[model samples]
Target: MNSKLLARIKVDAYCDKHLFYGLTNLNDGFDDSRIKYFSEKDFEVVLERVKSLGIGIFGIEPWKNGHYYDCKVYESHTSDPTDATWYMTCFENFKKRGDNIVYAASYFIPKKLLSE
Candidate 1:
């Protein structure tokens, strides 16, 4: 991801504090590792590196208060509120876009609080 994009994502994640913590807990330890691994500068460098590797990048932007986005990239609510599994299923559509490089933005939330 580019530094600008990464910063935007971090800002967005920070805005949704509860969801950010919930997502971090869901991913075990990856959330913290990701924060440490991707400094703003590193994100910019990775973007250039991936491009040089001939990989196309795809980003999934979360819709405020929405569970998922439509196949056309529009945000929508899932038919079943009880099953949040739709969140993962939505990725299947992106997977069909042909393999290059697929990085999901939701993967970046941090685990421990900053003071920790």
Candidate 2:
């Protein structure tokens, strides 16, 4: 499969909601265990997609945030509420319970006035 297309698909799937970026527990911790990410080669591709179509970035002021922000993706295994290492690779058994959620962080544009 084309890597770019794959990356686009991942972003499209995750952006089902109005959020420009967020975390969710939809992908079962199995077959699709691949952590959807936007770094290295896929970073730019994913970012662009989100910027053009993503919502909730400015929460009704899209022009304020400059459309969207640079986003990073991460994944977790166990659904343990005690785990705070979301930045690190996760590998537990919450998949069986269908609780492995993914995480994402996007750097919002610094507070700035929109140039009309």
Pick the TM-score winner: 1
Per-residue lDDT over 7-33 for candidate 2, one digit per residue giving the tens place of the 0 to 100 score:
545544445443334434332443234
Candidate 2 has an lDDT of: 0.31
- Write candidate 1's Cα lDDT for 1-116 as tens digits: 89778675664554244222322222224434343223223333433433343322233332212223223221354443222334334445544654333233432323242112
Candidate 1's C-alpha runs over 4 A off are 1-75, 79-83, 107-116
For model 1 the local lDDT of residue 74 reads 16
User: Against the true structure, candidate 1 has what lDDT?
Assistant: 0.35
User: Highest lDDT, which number?
Assistant: 1
lDDT of 1 at 31: 37
Candidate 2's TM-score reads 0.23
